[model samples]
Target: MFQQKSYQTQVSGTLYLVPTPIGNLDDMTLRSCKLLKECDLIASEDTRNTQKLLNHIDSQVPQMSLHEHNYRERVPQLIKLLKDGKTIAQVSDAGMPSISDPGHELVVACIQEQIPVVAVPGPTAGLTALIASGLTPQPHYFYGFLPRKKKKQVEELQKLADQVATLIFYESPYRVAATLEAMRMVFGGERQVVICRELTKIHEEYIRGSIDELCEYLQETVLKGECCLLVAGKLEEEPILAEYSLEDGLEMIATRVAAGTKATKAIKEVAKETGLSRQELYSAYHQEE
Candidate 1:
């Protein structure tokens, strides 16, 4: 419920959520570079990996590890620094911070403490793959990294079975084949799917086909690097009644009644099955032939 006018002057130091390149160093934003260089401290998912980016940008800002193992412990310490008016910038190894990466907990802590938090937009693998996926772009659901266990993965997919929005998921190269097979089982083999690998790097590839086709293709072709899987949503089709002529519907009603079902019951059953209005069926049933 708090308003964050990031540029406004404030007593507390700001927390900047900077996005690093997913693969190519060229994708790094100018604002991201400036913030990383200017911030008092850089909290990184992996200091060693971040050092590479820092070296590329010529930034020697001090960094401390704030990954999954220590994010919980580090939140309080970062929050204290912010309160003491020391600006802190958080970055994952690649892509945006706190998005399938570390920094979500710290951002929450900052908000609770009424600290200013600013996010600089940059490249992300999911959206990058999605535009090239040739699927509907507007309505999309990004589910980053499914559960590793087979049973749990199946359970999660079952919940999304009826989702009408395009689905996006991140997967490791090693598990991409198995995950595609599981998706084919839950979402059916005919559903269109795209597998984007290595993102902006030189080896970047987008493999597009039906779920079953991709499942077969991956068995022979080995893949490396982070993968983004985009699946088309279930197609919305008109009800069966759209295909049923009045004569065909009436014949179905007559058949059901002749099978010892009452006339009213037959009309109701046929109406329900064909998605026709009960009154429409009744009127047609009573109308002269």
Candidate 2:
């Protein structure tokens, strides 16, 4: 049986997951602005950064830091405050909370503890760039950041090489060139790629070309601002590979698990694509002991 929580009745002691603008301040919605002002306390990823936003919106709401380091200590405190009937607004440094940012842990705890967690959708770098990317927008896969290690990053990309949907990734401006080189190596030099930088800000720019062309351009041009990389999906001439192997499914699950996806979820996704029995795949995958 499916369980449901009626969020409409969630008025008090609520956890509001608010999204701040990614780059431009004007993109901040009126509703989010009002909610932040009225929420009892603001749980900010970076209190200083969020303070600047509060300043921009003319809000004087009190804030407490809830970032990567302190979230473990803070989640329980926030839950207690929520139970005591204090509404809170959670904001990341930019864009949405918990999407390539902190707050996932807190959200999980809230759901487990029966606290209302309402997400206030506003902006995200991935979807913002994807819409204008000119690639296959639908069925896109959003992989926030690639693995930092060279070998692991290659392995992760190689595992996703066969995906037919446009691939969206978030990258730092400093590392984007190296990331492009990695893409060139894995997805080939001819794959189409678009990099949206300083999104919605004054100096916003979209650098678009084949992987090789962009790599050559970045050599001469210095890219600034946070970046979103959108790459066209693999174009397989054949609809299906006749020789699809079970080993391929296993590797996919392994990579997903290594990337922090739960084993059962990884198995379920891979199983759907591979037409393997869910129970059998789960057994085979968990048998790694």
Candidate 3:
């Protein structure tokens, strides 16, 4: 727990979290460019990829690779530099750092050491695609990338099946189709989904439709570049029994039990679907018998 007055004069060096352009170079902010220019060192997720951006901006700042594979090893070295009063700027390959990118550990280290951590906001892929996808903007959940394994991915989707906020996910081009198929299976075919590909680039495209439609389209078309998927939230509605009478509810529960559902489980399910009390349903069902 520390208080940070970012602009105030301090004894130690600063750790700047700078956001780079997601695709278009023009999206890079002037402050971000200036910070990159002034910082003593630039810790990049991918030095080669970042070099191109630096070259484009004509910045000659020296950089070191700091990615998932080497972040732990490099964190202590970076902290030492900060302790010695040398400013460092952290950047990802694209978009914002630590949003499905590296930089979280370094930031945590800086905070623990009471180093001044300054953030210069710029572009982010998730929010960039979200607004353009025509989904609910305010209440959104950004799940950067799902698990790569099929079963794990399905399990994760099941966890978010009942979320009432717009769901966002990042996926590679090769897995986009399969991920869409998995989502359709978990969320139902009619659920609305938006696929944003090659965002902010010349060939950027958005495919918006029901999950079933998108799944079919993906089967025929091969997508290029990374993708951001936006899915509509679960519909909030009255319970199934809102319009049904007690007799109707009882009949539904009986049918489910007849179809091999345990009697107790069927009653509980009916109670949940109808928004009725489980104890009340049990009593009523027993009384009717």
Model 1 steric clash pairs: none
Arranged by TM-score with the best first, the candidates are 1, 3, 2
Question: Ten residues in a row with the worst lDDT in model 1?
Answer: 237-246
Task: Compute the lDDT of residue 7 as modeled in candidate 1.
Answer: 91
Off by over 4 Å in 3: 238-289
For residues 15-66, write the lDDT of model 3, one tens digit per residue: 9999988889999888999988888999999999999999999999999999
Predicted structure 1, TM vs. truth: 0.84
TM-score of each: 0.84, 0.80, 0.83
Give the range where candidate 3 is weakest over 10 consecutive residues by summed lDDT: 238-247
List, in order, the clash count of every candidate structure: 0, 0, 0
- Tens-place lDDT per residue, model 1, 2-86, is 8888898999999998999999999988888898899999999999999999999999899989988998789999999999999
Q: Which is the leading candidate under TM-score?
A: 1
What is the model-wide C-alpha lDDT for candidate 2?
A: 0.88
Query: What local distance difference test score does each model get?
Result: 0.91, 0.88, 0.91
- Name the regions of candidate 1 deviating beyond 4 angstroms: 239-289
